[model samples]
Target: MELQVLVLRPIFFFFFFVFLTILQQSSSARVLTITKPDRHDYAASARWLVSQNSWGVLSTLSVDHKGAPFGNVVSFSDGLPEKGNGIPYFYLTTLDPTARNALKDQRASLAISESPLGTCTRDPMNPTCSKLTLTGKLLILEGGSEEAEVAKKALFTKHPEMMDWPKDHDFRFFKLEIIDIFLINWYGGAKPITVDEYLHAKSIKLASFL
Candidate 1:
């Protein structure tokens, strides 16, 4: 009886180990499959990515003798569409030459990226930065426009420090009428998304969160 008990104990332990190994592999496979984002979800993720960033690289065409690409760090605010509208937009205050050049060219791109926060250093192979580049026409608002007012309020709400600046400062309000947005997850392929598509995606995500 004693010998039989010992033999059964070894068999039970071996099966238990095998069962746990199979379970672990199954969970790992599910995780890998779930990480892929669909078109709509990718757009929503892009908007969420922009919302999380406060600073971004504003790329513009040079107005000087050389028609080079100029990039500058700028503080920006994302615009939420009106009650029924589903367009993606953003606003920023700029008086820099790059901004002027972009306005003249009417084409510009903003790259918003977020780095992982915490004490741990990021792995080089797997960077902690998530980026989204939004391409659009740069429109300057000088005179009174309802859209201008709405943009100003949104900007102030996000960055109250801008309110301390003098009213006559060369800093002017500029809006980016987003035509296409591309999100690169860890420097992957550029996923193209339209304004309406992004908004619709965002609505779905918000619903899920609620």
Candidate 2:
């Protein structure tokens, strides 16, 4: 009886571990990081990605390519972390083609990803990793305007280097007037999130606590 007990205990433990692992995988096919909000909460997920990420691909209609899509890596801010208004703001200079192209054609898009958060275990392109693309007119903020003031504070607080950039670089504050928001946060297809949903989505910290 004693020999049987010892042999069965090891086997029991092994099977138990396998059961737990299979159960875990089944429950969370796409694991949400400890810092990340639940994927089902699409609005919160989208807002979290935008607020946490400092950089993304800003896509614009190319001037040199006669309307080919041009995507450039750029730094941006959505207010101060948790205090964000959900609208992405950029500091750009006309010396760069992104700002130059936006001037000619207001149509533009900013694509951000959750991969940068260092939470995703899968490939960056994997749907479970999550990605957001905000499409809208990229409008330049008027200097000395109220919105511009907010933008300046938002940008400088997040990226201090912008403040010390050469004054003659023609650097200006630009914002994505998001007309559409596309978000993929799970195994399912794109979530049914709108610009309003994303803008109004509360901070992940608040949402999780509530």
Q: Least lDDT summed over 10 consecutive residues: which range in candidate 1?
A: 30-39
Model 2, 100-147: lDDT tens per residue?
999999999999998877788999999999999999999999999999
User: What tens-digit string does per-residue lDDT give for candidate 1 at 1-210?
Assistant: 999899999999999999999998866432221122343466756766555445677777888736788877777766432221223234444456766786679778887654522111455234334467788777787646887676677667657788887766566677777778877654456655677877666342222111
Candidate 2, pairs of clashing residues = none
- Give the Å shift of residue 77 in candidate 1: 0.9
RMSD of 1: 11.5
Error of 2 at 33 (Å): 13
The lDDT of each candidate is 0.61, 0.87
* Position 107, candidate 1: lDDT: 79
Best by TM-score: 2
Q: Stretches of candidate 1 above 4 Å error?
A: 1-40, 80-94, 116-128, 186-188, 204-210
TM-score of each: 0.65, 0.80
Best by lDDT: 2
Candidate 2, residue 13: lDDT: 99
Instruction: Provide the lowest-lDDT 10-residue window in model 2.
Output: 201-210
